[model samples]
Target: MALWGGLGQAATVAQLVGADVGGLISNIIQAAATARQNKKECEQLARRVLMIADLLPHLQDPEVMRRPEVRRPLTGIDDTLREAHELVTSCQGKSAAYQFVMAGRLADRFRDVQSRIDSYLLVFPFISHIDITRRLDRIYNILLSNDTAGPSSSAGSQLDVLVSQEVLVHRHGVGKFTLKELVVATNNFAQEIGRGSFGRVHKGVLPDGREVAVKSLGKASSQHGWQGLLRELDVVSCLRHKHIVHLVGCCVVRQKKSLLSFWRKNVEKQEELLLVYEYMKNGSLHDHLHGPSSSSSPSPVMASWKMRIEILLGVSRAIEYLHDYAGVIHRDIKLSNILVDSSWVPRLTDFGVVVNWDEA
Candidate 1:
């Protein structure tokens, strides 16, 4: 049983909800505080972890954990904890300057966790949620005080604004298709292939009989997902890398037809957004490395260090392209975001939450 008063629902694992946030905190505390930057970043990450810790116990209720809606946010939290654990541990015994460099990466990870927690706030008790926007404001002020950049172009201030912040999406780069086309391709949304936090994906065959994966955004997150789709289209449409998911087309179905009353109208609520991509026969690296989704046995090919290193290198190149050439930040980079094909080659997907360096 969980501590404090008995919970009505079976407790969802605290480790699952809170993940390694606490562990990261303790690890940082034990490490030698060599540089001002290292210590500052450590404190900031601890704060983020503490915010997550506050919500952990409350989310243990079976009612909350059992909800399908909670799965996505929960997975994101788990991924963050995993990344933090790796990062903090890797910094051990490094020089003060090296740790300082790692601090920069930690900031990126903190913002990624910030974006992940937004979805979690929707489904459960995030009643004490911290205001991330205010956190960004603090960074902005700090930059101004330090004279890092002029008011017009504050680099620290830009990074302070979370990737979840709204932006004007553009459409000059990608193909726009209608709902009819999507329906025809998916055979009326047949073949339930997989699912993610935003929506479900269906396997489809194109007019040329080429295989594809169609992702449909969920209703509750329709607006959020649309913004992401716009961002994804803008990013992926311009990039051509072997390790990047190809953006075949997209669908946005909006209806203006109203019932008798405005209050009863299903306007934006009824809209649908879908994105099409080339199908990956092997699904995701998460499935292979950890184990098959439906089974306990790990994929032998992926379990090898040699294969894993190659997979890691391919993903690194793709990310380098996004950062160095495309000039965008992939706020969400987790195992599930990396897909693999029949040859077990890794490819990056889901660019909706990526922020341009300028936009930060």
Candidate 2:
């Protein structure tokens, strides 16, 4: 009764919904009752003990007392007896249906209680019900597989695992975008404005007539799960610079999909990573520097001596800001990665392969 009350009180403290708590408590009580019934059933299955002892000679050895084979069996027997005693002490106050059903099952696995108990204790509860269910399912699959498989796969790399967990727990306000919206914005990834080692970029026009450039990365299959994408997301989401091209928004499917991080930080409220940004009208400096028109003509629209100097100065300042203020390194510092806005204001774009050089 005391133990039952303690569980009931714990349920209350956990703030479980009345319906959920009611179900859990009922199940627990049912399980306890089933244990008592199993004890009674065991009395009738006297032949079961003989068969078990025959199959497990370890139970006969004097050292069996210290071995799991003997300890588990004895422990199960003790629990069964105790459960029966408790049911009788209740004077039939609670239903014994749970006990009877539970005992039938326990009797079937009478030799494996220690393993089951060890497994049950290792499962840590999660705040999300889905997480708990997933963990339990994982455990069941692992056990069912007889330990042949490796540990369950996570969404990110080991470091990324920590970041994802922290974000879910602490960064609750962050919104996730979908792949469809990105596809639509980027015109099915057809208008190739720029290309990089990681992916390609295209010019896009949002519904409100706002211009944006969307970078479509290569497909990520099972080879690059959440952690790989998550590491990229974590790094890109937090980047902020006046001259840096902003990440406006991104979207991805939970299980299998590409990730899109946006940069759209308002003047007053700045997000360290993840964004929606003001788009640049003109394409990257690469389009003007080594593009077909620039390479053939030797003088693109923005490649005049005067404009070239301004572009160089602008890019230099952008690099300095990222290096000094943000502690970031623009590794691929070629002309093509730089963009010119409507006012000819140059912005540094693409940090997909950037490095961190805080000291320098």
Candidate 3:
């Protein structure tokens, strides 16, 4: 088999190995297409194996493939694909009686291959963060295409919600919240927490009882404000890190209303954009340093030399991560933008003015 044939090869020749493995996976997929027994299971296995095949090209970098983390999963995928091929090929050209006798066993084999492929793919390290972001954008586009196909059924809506929650929250580290949902969470925007160039922040509680800070875009009507909102979303959605402020999700509300006037007046449509973030209960580093909290009876926690050092280190690491791993440059890094969580861990925020290093 191709799997065993490629073993014991030099790590530096990973590109060649990846190509060979990909070709084997293609053959397996082709074999699965002709499967008579366990047709559904065979198709499922093919789909899972294809996902691995899609990732193989990205692993062609010799240095990346040499890493144990990457190499082990690639090897596991190879072995699983080999077994999958054998399982699928066995089901082809089988007599009905033979298929019936071995149906359960074949089904188990397919399930095992599917499970192994999924586990291996789960551990596959993303070689490029930009590529990951692009993939996520493609997923979001697919969702949008489905939504615009036609009027949605309840079942379809439920599926879309499930997909959005799973793919957006778990994979992309973000969520999509509706305006009505935000209204209920924020008590109709009753509590004002802070303000920024883009919008006003309101304190809110999510349906799951988690506190959040909702920034309602004040400049949605202006071209500059609209661009800022898009820029912030573009930059923040792709970032996932410990010391970075987690973007819970965003809400975009569009409404059409007619303007009745003596002069020429038509329907006006506007989008209300809001970004939700994890609530920083301890507030900003600026608040602790120069605000009322830093007065005569200052917060002892912020006053601690060790705590301050840790906070500084956390903020520095966040900046370093942005520059190195994410290829981002946060142009507006100020004390006020450095939020502190309940544990006093500093989180870097306000990416509205951030730029890609390439662009910078």
Candidate 4:
């Protein structure tokens, strides 16, 4: 009855909440300088950015992550950061004067977001103004790099875009999986082994010949799942033990339809959500307990009393580790959630409804 398990069913995106504040600031500063229009305004925007830049280290501080208070403000700032990045991106190919206008508008946004975060900082009193000032100074040095006014007047070109893409990769811990790669690994999702409220689960074989289970969340399920995705990802990423299921990675592709573009690229877009996990060789304990088997008779591999007690002990230990060591609660424990390996060792799985023990 010994089972090994990890407790994540469908993680929402919140677990991926960390933003490279330094990178975002760099992008905005670089873009603004290239679009040189109002030198005074550009400097003003740079100063304003000092506020958000100062908060970067604190936002990324391990202690800050431990506090739920930071999550809301951080999320708010994450939006502003993304908006600033996109605003700078959209300014590309625009006139210098237009870029200046966009930069001013974005600076105002940075100020507003910073104001909101300042209030959140009250909870983390140890994060001193001096700490922020030092980070801001570092940002100032970076912003004043000689790329001002940009080169060849095409400052908003592919080179800048490539730099931004590079920063994007550093933030995603599990590494982004391409839709094409996933297509090949899942054999076009050809092998369907189970279905659930969230979506279908397909047993897949990676390019490296490793077995995996890919769970695809339907649009409706994703809409609901987004509420808890980040927390799940955060919890599962930290959990490492012999009895827990391992999360290899995940895929979250989004698409939207558009009319014919200037280059006439395809307008069709879609949103696909997928979670990848290590394949459990022996399926779930529920299957062996009360589920169907190959021979339609009471199999000799019956749940002996000794094996049953061992299974209970294994599950208890898994729960104990999650609760005491990980500060996580296995919220949806059941027979089906306990999976098994080739050795009849039970592992825990499916953490769709987990909660931080402290919060609980």
Candidate 5:
């Protein structure tokens, strides 16, 4: 059978209401109750499905439902709910080994369903115009909360689990580095190469004798900074391309310290986030275009029309890859963010603010 079977047909509100949405919702709830693994994710999906079910009544008005905007999102929700039902049901009565093996895939499926449902809710017109706005907001907040908690938290330990277990093992071959290893590699942060809004960059030599540029998140002690670091890691770890900066590995360390109080002594800890990438010997495009020289002129390479065109084409290809294949937008695109290797191949770096196109 086709996935999202009903999506091939034009769906009317009456047909959707009279059809299997209610049945699908009920099945999802029952399946979630018996889920052996990913139970919390299943339950969250069920709640969001029920909330969407409540909005169906508001969408049933003949005039409002006739509009393509309203009908299309409703149809999408219907299809998504069916998928959710199937996903939850599959988790029931499975053997421990089966569940363990499928845990990561199941989690990814749940996250995809939740994201789709959230998107439909945002685009569904009646929710915003009617009395359901507050309910919609609650559902939206629940989705956001689920997204940022547990495996998605900015805490060093949680991020470590996400990067090492989920990302490193499955998607890319990015490794996890220790603080001591990084300190030794960078000579205790001795050679500063560059700096950006998030942190400073340093030149380092890996134990393998490969050169790398290390970006340290200077403000990771604060909540916002930690979140930004998490965002960058999450985006960059999954991407692999010739024109994109390669993520060699990452380091997340929690450093402990003791504090003296008037009454007693206390202990505290802070996390440090760092990303390692292949070193670009030629530096950033901004430096070639604007950095000072004895002759007060741009670099010979930058002054060449042929070289500039080649650089532009390389950058364009990278952006195209990010949009068409990777489904992400590089929100930060600038001369300084684009680095070149000795071969003059441009590498797009900095993804702290990158967002999925759907979310954008």
Candidate 6:
């Protein structure tokens, strides 16, 4: 059997190796075909370049091609092309093999350098310090074809690995978490600390030992199968702010058992539809402002009128940051989701219900 044939079914293998090889293979093949096509294009370009060199004198006025400065550079290029043409033409037997080998190496090096230049120009005529590395990937085939002369599956595979490496690094920096890491962190969604109309919340700790509150979602009352959860997750994960609750990460995988695991409760398996967060110790403002005093405390640290006013201002500032600065609207702004820290710092929580004005 193939090493990965039934591997997708095994949770361990699926988590470690990922279940995207078929997709990656398809992408690699597509890129290779593109590179092959590009090589043909570059071959055509080579012909054109030769033609342009030959016709330079006739195409341009004598004055343009003859001026000492302008003529010198054209003459230089003409001489270089002449040398290349002679080297290519003079190949007899073994010398021809050597010339072809040298040409391939030179072309490969030129193509690599050309690929870097094209990468810079991707989002360019725009900025010098800017990088649109992913766009460069779209023309991988063309660049490879120009450089390599012909396509090889091995070369495609190599390029696939290279691109994957770069994208993976970028993803890590962008704060992507794998499925297993989320699963173990949330105690398999066992501990339900909070609940609401949209979902149940659970407490978890990250690998770094940071405590986090995870909101495990349920199917929307109107929609089936957690479709709305996904949209919310995507939006929240992209949003970054100091005042708003930081969305650490989320999980979205589709496998028969794994999908079933989320709704089911077996000790051995758990499904994941939870958003990780930085846990707040001092509960919500509703709790502090209204809930009964805790038994452990000698007496609740009741907020004076001044403290109360300060707390209200803190909440207002959080909303202002989201609405005016971040261009987001807290559609469900209320006292319950406004959490307080040990330092009495108020944090805007519960982004699940927030409305993105930009999206609207």
Output the number of the TM-score-best candidate.
3
Predict model 3's lDDT versus the native: 0.70
Cα lDDT over the full model 1: 0.60
* Tens-digit lDDT track of model 3 for 1-360: 333233323233335345356556778879988887778888888777666655555554565456665555456455667788888888888899999898788777777877778787776555444345555565555545654574345645454455444444555566788888999999999999887667788999998999999987774356456556656866788888999999888875533211111012221334466889999998988888877643567775556999989988999999999999999899988899999998888998887777888898
**Between prediction 2 and prediction 5, which has the larger TM-score?**
5
Q: Model 3: which ten-residue window has the lowest total lDDT?
A: 256-265
Cα lDDT computed for each candidate against the true fold: 0.60, 0.47, 0.70, 0.58, 0.71, 0.50
How displaced is residue 127 in candidate 6, in Å? 7.1
Q: Is candidate 1 or 3 superior in TM-score?
A: 3
Model 3 clash tally, residue pairs: 0
Q: Deviation in angstroms for 353 in model 4?
A: 1.0
For lDDT, candidate 3 versus 4, the one ahead is 3
Candidate scoring better on TM-score of 4 and 5 = 5
How well does model 4 score by local distance difference test?
0.58
Encode model 6's per-residue lDDT on 72-113: one tens digit a residue.
322333233333333222332334456466767646644553
Please give the clash total of every predicted structure, in order.
0, 29, 0, 23, 0, 4
- Lowest summed-lDDT stretch of 10 residues in model 1? 257-266
**Residue 314 Cα positional deviation in candidate 6, in Å, after optimal superposition:** 1.9
lDDT of each residue in 1-360, candidate 4, tens digit only: 000010111011134355555555666667756643444544455444555454434444444355554455446555665565555455456677766666667667656645554554453344443334444454334323523443442432433333223222322345456678788998898988665435677898988898988877654654345434434554666688878888888775533211111112332333454667788887777787787666666523264777667778888999999988998897878887887777767688777668886778
Tens-digit lDDT string for candidate 2 (266-354): 12211122223457887677776666663455644444788888878888888888777767776777777788888777888766566
Write the residue-wise lDDT of candidate 5 on 126-184 in tens digits. Answer: 54454243433443444345434622334434433432343344433478888899999
lDDT, residue 147, candidate 5: 39
Error of 3 at 53 (Å): 14
lDDT score for residue 131 of model 6: 26
